[model samples]
Target chain A: MDAAARLFSERGYHGTSMQHLGQALGLQRGSLYAHIGSKEELLFDVVNQGAERFLGMARHAASSGEPAAARLRALLVGHVSTAAQHLEASTVFLNEWRYLSPVPRAQIQAKRDLYETVVRRIISDGVAAGEFDPGVNVAMAGRLVLSAGNWIYTWYHPDGALSASAIGAELFDLILNGLAKEGPA
Target chain B: MDAAARLFSERGYHGTSMQHLGQALGLQRGSLYAHIGSKEELLFDVVNQGAERFLGMARHAASSGEPAAARLRALLVGHVSTAAQHLEASTVFLNEWRYLSPVPRAQIQAKRDLYETVVRRIISDGVAAGEFDPGVNVAMAGRLVLSAGNWIYTWYHPDGALSASAIGAELFDLILNGLAKEGPA
Candidate 1:
């Protein structure tokens, strides 16, 4: 899965082929079928699994018994940390999912929509509970938080100056305080 | 340029060829070179011009005599508005620059670095003037702002619920208040 994700990220889904996968994995062309059925299936698996990881983290965080702000914080941490830890898969998930065939594409998008809804609900809840400003645009704010975390995969190197956790902490502070009411809740 | 950018965004850079551009433009293969050099030149033009538009907007806003918060607001408005107005070119600039040759790639990167530095300095200045929290990580905050604004192209639609300026105002409000010092500047 990691190898497939890395290749897909580097060369793109259409540019990579089963032969390249075989070369990378040291498998005979005929023997490769035993592990993976077809190139599309591999692409499906890589994309589906990648989406599942993100959606799973978001689902778990959204359902946690924490306050809306805490839930949002947890979601941010999960989002940035997962993207950093699974940088290749996150890249494939972000850019290469468009290559999936219709059925798998729909499935992945449904999962993505669910994850987005989870984020939206948290922000809306925050707004309702007065944890966030009442005038906040729930949908736009949700997308902003997700984009801010998602783009980290584009530039956050594991060995770079800041670890994923450090970045997450800074983002959490920035976001929560940003969303806070001017005076007090 | 729009056709080329849409094609590049739809098809990976390597997957797109001179023939694809000619077909998209309804030009004969031989006549294509009369208007554009090679496919690479087209890619460079698309990416560089898109980047230039962004950097120009940022530079203009950065050099304005506004306070840090107002300058940041101008930058966000410019960033999101430009991306929304030039969706196809923005898409290619965000994703297809890796396909450029080393020289063009470096030129683009240099411009990107300049943009990044401009944002960082604004945040750092805000911190120094006691407008934003002193402990804010200037570099990370800068990337967060860019990522949040840059990702606007992904979900922003011309006919969507909000206009580009509405979204920009909301983002500006979120970011400025989020970075504000505890009591007063």
Candidate 2:
């Protein structure tokens, strides 16, 4: 699965073939059939693997007994770290996820929605607790947070100067602190 | 150019052929050569077109002589609104931009860097003027703003009940105001 992800991310899905996957692992084409049915299956495997990591992070954060802000930080940081650590899988999920079959796509989307719902819940709690501003729209805020986290796939390299944790902490500060020179930014 | 963008974004670069493009516009494959010389030209044409829009927006904002915040708003709102309006071209810019040849790729990249540099200068000036937080990281913040604006290609739908300007305004407020439920969030 790791090899599959690495290959798929480095070379696009269209650029990869069953034969290439076989060659990378010193296995013949026929042997690969024992492990996977087809090309789409490999793509699905990589997507599923990446989705699970993100889902687990969200679930853990939601279940944790932290305050809303803390939970949000955990979720955001977990997402950034996941993207950094599993760059290939993360890239595949962020970029090639549209290639899944309808059923698999629905399943993957449900997981994604589940993650968003968790973020929304935290935002809701934040608003209710007056920890967040009343004007913060949950759906839009959820999308924004998800965008900020997921878009890390485009630039967050493990080999990059800033570590994932450092980026996460800084983002946490920015989100919690805002950017405005005046009031909370 | 718009027709090519629609075909390429709806399908993909490698997934699109000159004949497919020809078919989309009801033209014979051989005749397409009269206007478009080759497959690579379509990719470059569409990318170059989108880059021009983005660079135009950035140029306008940088020259507006407004305060940093107002100019930043113009930069953000202009890019996002234009992206939403030209859905197909925006998608090509976001997703299929990698298909350009080395020389043209460098050109596209240069335009992209210029756009980023424009926004970075705004943030830097704002920070220096004490209108933005002194702690602001101009480059990272500019990229974050760009990423947030670009991901609209992945999820936004024109008929989905939200207007482009409204979405841009909401996003601008969120990024400008931030998510923190704290002293300044």
Residue A121 local lDDT, model 2: 98
DockQ of each: 0.42, 0.59
Per-residue CA lDDT of model 2 for B120-169, tens digit only, reads: 99988888888888887776778667877888888888888788878877
lDDT of 1 by residue, B1-185 (tens): 88899888887676687889899989988999999888889989999999899989998999898778778889988899999998888988988787687898999999999999999988787777766777677887788788888888668889988889788877877766652234121
Strongest candidate by TM-score: 2
Q: Which regions in candidate 2 have their CA more than 4 angstroms from the true location?
A: A26-28
The predictions' CA RMSDs to the true structure, in order, are 2.7, 2.0
Q: Which ranges in model 1 have alpha carbons more than 4 Å from their true place?
A: A28-30, A179-185, B179-185
lDDT of each: 0.82, 0.82
